[model samples]
Target: MSVLNETYTLSNGVTIPKVGFGTWQIPNGDAAYDAVTTALKTGYTHIDTAYAYGNEESVGKAIKDSGIERDKVFVTSKLPGEIKDAEEARRHFVETLANLGTDYLDLYLIHAPWPWNRIGTRHDEGNLEVWKVLEEQYRAGRIRAIGVSNFDVHDLTNILDNAEVKPMVNQIQYYVGFTEPTIVDFSQKNGMLIEAYSPLATGDLLHNSQVQGMAAKYGVSVAQVALRFCLDNGVLPLPKATSEAHIVTNAELNFTIDPEDQEALRHLSDSAPEHFHNSTQG
Candidate 1:
């Protein structure tokens, strides 16, 4: 089967496309629309966007223009990180649906445990309020599955302990040279699929000579090796690309890394000289 057609079933039995086309840094107008349209043309079945990304309208329009049935494609969007009120979350979900020109979302997520500006502040109570709203929507069939992004153990545990429904997924930053092993292990054990944002590490891995050497052995781009690393570790990868060429080739994951090479890739997590933290996780 083509990698594009492969999927991971959410805990709720919702099937999500393995490679989610991300619309993170893209602008809201023609850029977002054209990129999404290109990805769909190149055979990506899953599309990931966020309220914070400010391109939901364009992403939705691109999907509509692609001529694919809505059911044939899986769509996901995030609730803004700042929304802790139940009513606000509810209202936003409606707005998201309208923006997408759809009736139900394949998946929806809390953008983060805390607002983007207040990253580390504890929001146990507030997060619970948002989760309740997500739960309400999921139960109502408006959302097929619900999850979170950028949530660590403490954030996830708060919701797990307090809510009737556990988050079905946790989207985090995972790449060849970076990972949150503790959070990954904890969330998976509790039945959450880890969706990896920045799976390409914001194109940073492409400039690494060591990573380039490794990719040369497989005759695959560094991006493919990085994406396959996420898949091998059982994490879904959401990669963003604007050019048609990049979007087409990004989905090509027809090769696998041997155990020894995979180990070398894992070791780079700590040893890699430079790292970036300026990108948003939505």
Candidate 2:
């Protein structure tokens, strides 16, 4: 039996499980399939993957193998940064749906603000076209909600300015460290739900004094402290795990940090250790 459970409601009234299994580095093989199966058996209902990850097919297979109904789980996939134009974006959507073997996506995100390759060479202009295309999909009921990832306040504002349908979610790299205060507040003020990836600071804060102290005080792991910070701060956190222990441990984050502890954690963000995003890690 699984014990980890937390949830948040998106701007579109969709209730998303706050804690999810992020398949960022889980390779598409027996290990990947086993990891996902373990995560679901351990009570994870949210699965986050991307076309760039090249494992959506395996993820779909894993879910189907688990005997879990499609609607019982919340799956999120992203558009590869290279396909940023309307036509390519439309093709990307169709491909992702086919790969995942799902008719409708619970949530779909524009993978990143930084476009890749030379497909559509107009920078953010391609993103706008992609957004409109996704909007059309949402209106057609192929995608339940549309959102963006790695977008700053400027990118979000630009979309809002020209979009016929407002984005319901913004998936960003947020943790107690690297809070991105302006973007966080701006999204909240505009009624957009912020889904946090790398919310554990990619494991950088697992042994920090603040988090460790809170963990010792609360009798939980330091990761739980960091996860509690994100959840309590109103950011929906999706921490990745390839093992069942981590999947369960990451979900066992329903603890609390008092006001003083929360403040200390916030202050520690300034002294955040190096490689905050783990960009250097292989």
Candidate 3:
């Protein structure tokens, strides 16, 4: 199948692929390395990983194995919440590059807004300093783009207020089941891209009745319905996979969803309960 490659123009003129291979739950080593290799060979030009994920070496190995030119792929990673201070943040970026076997990243994000009081509380006021450091990295060309993840409207606005280089993207927990329109609207207005992690709801919404019905009408899988839902709404979807079949399936997002179906899914989000790692156990 032909790979679906949609591009988004960042505020600074860098274009990133709309569909990225997310490596959140995947661990470090052979398995993770295999997944990254498969994803790249299957035509994924964008890869999303994090310092917290502990799989950068595996991802690096896969990229090396593919023998593909490094400039062709857009690689992204995050600064851990615990390392929010400037010196630690700078140190973390260096270590992240060493692990990924790259000198610079396509994008880098503040993993979260000081969650768990690791850097500071989510409501803490020190988060702006962290964002400032990331902004500096972007200016220095060490990181091509800088952004944040898991930031709500308030956390984002705080950064915007103090930032020299506006954030290029905001990676967040958004999907068919837990869509946050407010965040989308706010980010787009400011020219920051919204990268929707868990775009399939971590498989929680794959078998949902609404999703299933939509898929049947469109003659696609429920997973496709959810992924298309994100793409249609302008949120770049990052789907995870460790196998060839899953990677290929995700790359087949070239078709458009029906207008009525898109509207229906938007309404469904208002009533659907949230599902993720944190909510699943509760």
Candidate 4:
């Protein structure tokens, strides 16, 4: 019973795979191509990428070359977040489709509340404008689901309070150490599914002795423990890996962690031994 066979129902009734193959820093050419191709061959039914990742073309090409039915794989991408205007939002959405060579997307997200360099500047009204564009595309059937990423409660509230359609997903920088209680609770409570980006904390969690101990108890790797931790918390994890071993092993979540140990992991004093915590990045 590998978890790769499992799926989660979104707020709008669209089903996405529980595990997602992430292509964040994988680069555009062979790196992204090979990783996405390997993930598909290894039975990954979900793929998450973004305009900021700058690898949608390669990711899409890999999926096309994999010989898998387009609809069989759940695909997700995001708007660059800086484009707060409706016109630019529409333009980027079209560009994303062209880059992926797909007419529609399983899911689409606003990459962030504000641009990367302008993190603290919450463009609430601008975000609302973009959200409305997303709502337009979603209603037109170009995107099966619409959502946001890296959104705190305040940013998400802008959409939830005024939009005709609420966000269906919120992709955040979640890991064992940073549970992001406020945003996660608000999103889930509002019927949005949480997708965890950097679930392994960019390889930081691989060295946590506490997590390692739990992995040892389960006879799995530290990555497996981290991935399962997200699932246990009702968050879908998007793990990025390039090697075939890692791409395959990442989704081989066949065993369940003990309830007691899970609680211990959730409340760990440190999630990754000084490497990763809430202050690291989001």
Candidate 2 residue lDDT tens string, 183-279 = 7788888878888888776677676776677789999887777777877788887888776777788887656678988887776753246644522
lDDT, candidate 4, at 222:
96
lDDT string for model 1 (197-252, tens) is 88877777678788889889999887888888888888999999998888988899
What C-alpha lDDT does candidate 2 achieve relative to the native structure? Answer: 0.80
List the global CA lDDT of all models.
0.88, 0.80, 0.81, 0.90
- Summing lDDT over every window of 10 consecutive residues in candidate 3, give the lowest-scoring window: 273-282
What digit string (tens of lDDT, one per residue) describes model 3 on residues 1-282?
343466888999998998899998899998889899889988898999999999999998798778989888999999987765778888888999999999889999988886544432464355677777787878788898888877767778888887788888988778775777677788889888999888877777776887788788878887777777888988888999876888888888767787887888887852235453322111
The predictions' CA RMSDs to the true structure, in order, are 2.1, 3.4, 2.8, 1.6
TM-score, cand. 3: 0.93
Cα deviation at 121, candidate 3, in Å, is 3.3
- Global CA lDDT computed for model 1: 0.88
Candidate 4 achieves a global lDDT of 0.90
Off by over 4 Å in 1: 270-273, 278-282
